[model samples]
Target: MTEALLELKDVYISYLGVEAVRGVSLRVTERDFVTVIGANGAGKSSVFNAISGLVKPAKGEIWFNGERIDRLTPPQIAGRGVIQVPEGRKIFPLLTVKENLMVGAFMQRDKKKIAENFENVYRLFPALKERPTAKGIRLSGGQQQMLAIGRAMMANPKMILLDEPSLGLSPIFCQQLSRQLKALHNEGKTLLLVEQNARMGLSLANYGYVLENGELRKEGTSAQLLNDDEVKRAYLGV
Candidate 1:
């Protein structure tokens, strides 16, 4: 079997005295698009936070490319090529569109590579290029979402963790973003996405996991879960 590019083993996390992620285990193989879907308080963001080193796992192991990373700092984790585009489009409100993207490449020193990455991100999201001088706060919701994704891409990550990529966009924008994510997958970017939109998440993902009350409730191929009656009733409203 191929080695997993990223793996979580019996991961647990807590805030104060409350456990947020309870013995969660998952894996992302190289270039695979995987998703975790759950209700509002099901610990999706906590899982991403632990993996990105924003919060250390209380009792489990996080491994990336065969190396243990649970004890690393956030910057250290990011430097190792695991990047996250957090929820709520956390762009610098005062920064220009171009500047916000440049922030994502801060760890790199190669000016030429940075410039190339900037150009590539602009090509991927021309709306950003057109408004390069605009402050991040001035962009629309959908544009901001695009900028968030573009910024993460600037890191040239081996795998990206995305939280709620379509949170507040219109239906059309959600579809468009989903297609872009699929394109990214085809181009060999491994992804671990957390989404509330179950249908869209499962449709785009190759493998899917369900989280409930901070624990893994189900796991399967996207197709299998999409058609499961319980999933449809709970997440799809069918």
Candidate 2:
């Protein structure tokens, strides 16, 4: 059996004594594309934050590459090749697209690697390459989202945790983003995505977990979840 690349073992997150993530657990294996789909305030972002070390889980272990990482600092966790494209496309509004991408490589000192990653990101999102000098705040919504993904790519992450990558976008842009993500997965990148777009999430990921009220409600292959009447009614809009 292949070992999981990322594992959250009954993780819990609390904010001001309010439970944000309630004993959520899941796994992402090498080259696997996994997703969690739920409505807003379902604690999906909290789970992503815990995996990235932004919010320490009040309990349970976060394991990455077979090591305990719940205790690691955000920077330390980042250095381990787990990167997140946070919700809201949190690009630096004042910075140029190029500048924002460079920020992703704060831990990297090698100019050669940085340059290589620049090419990689540009290849992934050609629109960003054309607007390198443009400020992040000026890009259209789709472009901003692309820039956010490009910026995260600059980190050369081994696995990416995407939070709502398709939020607030035109249908065309969402389609474009989906193709880009599928290409990444095809290239052997491991991904764990959280989204409220259940149809897109299930269509794109190989496996999925349904989150409701901060809890893992279901786990199955994409097709299985898509065919489930309960999931269909609540999330997929069948």
Per-residue lDDT of candidate 1, residues 1-238 (tens digit): 7899999999999999799999999999999999999999999999999999999888999999989999999998999999999999899889999899989888879898889889878877888999999999999998998899889988989999999999989999898888889888887899999999999899999999999999999999999999999999999999
How large an RMSD does model 2 have? Answer: 0.9
lDDT of candidate 2 over 82-199, digit per residue (tens): 9999999999999999999999988889999999999988988999989899999999999998888887888989999899999999999999999999988886788889999999
Q: Which stretches of candidate 1 lie over 4 Å from their true place?
A: none
lDDT of each: 0.93, 0.92
Per-model TM-score on C-alpha atoms: 0.98, 0.98
- RMSD, each candidate, Å? 0.9, 0.9
Question: Which residue pairs clash within candidate 2?
Answer: none
